[model samples]
Target: MLKQIANLDQNSGNTFKLLTDETGCCGDSITPCKYVAAVPVANSVSAVVVKDRDGNNQTVTFAAAATTVKAIRDALVTAVNSVGYEDDGNVLPGISVETVSTNKVVTIVGELIVVSLTTSGGSVAATATCTEVGICEFYVEWGGGASKVLTVNGVNATLGDLTFATASAANVKSALEGAANWPSGAVATVVKNTDDSIFEITVTNAQSTVAFILDGLRLTRSNCIVDYV
Candidate 1:
């Protein structure tokens, strides 16, 4: 069976490019951008419990019945960072909250574990949990299906086992960007088309015919796409 792309080949000198649906040109081409997916907001009210590396617990509660996802994320970051604000001590001190991909994904710099997630007040929802071990494994593919199983982390993690929320594609982007194995100058990004409910990932590099796989799906020229999980 096909494995992670990294196992199939090396980063030999191939150039990675993004194709446009409107124009057939790869890279340096302007394609009329549309929304593949709208940012996923909180469907029901919820609460998220964050446990930092220090084992400190910070609870952020969301009461909005149907608020923008961005608002919830901002509240979470603010609550996690506030000092002497309330009984819930700062869950992540000295750890910066950095948001990527239009605030869809928020990472607590230095490492913070999401212990429990609960949604209540208006409606109950599952909490957002982070299983980040500072490691990520990706299978990148290219022309003729040449591929490789690339690993990047402090330790050896299970290949193709890393998973995250589909609404927050930035989680995937953050994982790839956080890893060290990605070739220099090669970067990964996510885009949403307004017309559909899909999230497409593109890796652009001056050199390297790049495509990758996560969660058993192959991201290639033929199918470099993602959807709400």
Candidate 2:
């Protein structure tokens, strides 16, 4: 858990450092906080590796979608923010991203930040362009070693018990959204993957405009996949 909130371990001392120019070394009073810059090429992608307080590492990525400078920069902002976005069940460490983007140049700052960019960190493609595949849409895998239970509205139930691999799509939807937990509704897409397998039980969906927090529903394993339910 390499989080930037510093001080969880009182013995660690004030281990916070501000960002400085690439030339200057750490522990210096600098103009900008510690950050990485990049200029991505067309159809390029980027990722940030962050550690939590307990030495847990999580990689956040901005798929190779952004083709414009501003779009890539903005996407970087979102990608960095997605650090500990999900997985609230485990309550992992946290960090923040803030900077000034001018002329489509973006800067990410934190005490200890490791950033990887495609094309050029400061020299990227004509911005970035591409359609995002995942954001609000989630798929429910019928099988594949996923043992998920749902707490709908308020009642807890075994998802696998109600639905099986041969179940119809309508029944799958009923089992997911119209569960006993109407107070906080759930959503899903019951389509078969390339292998016609159901590895993921359910996901936060984008099928409808009406979105809710999914009151009692939570995945202890893959909850970190999305922030909003």
Candidate 3:
């Protein structure tokens, strides 16, 4: 997600993002909307099974004594985030859990792929959603310089981490395609636009919108530029 450079709102779009699962969901019917997970109800023991970045089932358990809304919310948030950030040490992609409050009622808000949850009565659940997509595109403009080194995400080679002073579209195509440094899927084709400066780099993936943010907000940008759509 190569967003705006200068904008009033930072989170609006002026952010640098990376792709994780090229076949992931994108707010479609097949998957439920974000923040739609059922509110957890405590039982003799309560747990929610969620899919992690690697499509692995991770279970977070809570004691039966923890019954307050805040207790549940805090525990859930901490547990979900901890798997991705703390326990995994940010090595794995973790589910993002958030909260929204109105008056005094707090709602668990986030894009979590809920599997199942147990309660005193029976069970409750929230469904996950994903869009049907198969392509990932990158629009880049290399600023002119000598021995220009551009780093996209992490791979510092052609396309992603390419070290080039001035190269043609063909040069860029080979770099990105040959490197195969894309989300999780492989590369399909590298097209050269009319400008002949590598206008767009298209990637093909089964997972729709190519969801997932890069490891960090860090980018060693010397001449690489991202054009937001």
The lDDT of model 2 is 0.40
Runs off by more than 4 Å, candidate 3: 1-45, 63-65, 85-108, 129-229
Candidate 1 local lDDT, 1-229, one digit each (tens):
0001121133423343121222444652311111111123333325556553346876666544324555655555545433211111222322222234542333322223444444432322223332221112233322111122443222222323223223345654555566556555556776543345444666654132343444345644432331111
The lDDT of each candidate is: 0.37, 0.40, 0.39
- The reply for model 2, stretches above 4 Å from the true place, is 1-32, 40-43, 55-57, 84-106, 118-229
Candidate 2, residue 196: the lDDT equals 60
Ordered by lDDT, highest first, the candidates read 2, 3, 1
Better of 1 and 2 by lDDT: 2
Q: Count the backbone clashes (under 3 Å) in each candidate.
A: 22, 36, 11
State the lDDT of candidate 2 residue by residue for 92-195, as single tens digits: 12222223343334444333344345443432322221222223443334442223455543456554443345555555566666555433434564554436
lDDT of 1 at 109: 26
> In lDDT terms, how accurate is model 3?
0.39
Tens-place lDDT digits, model 3, residues 23-61: 254632123223234443333226666666457877777
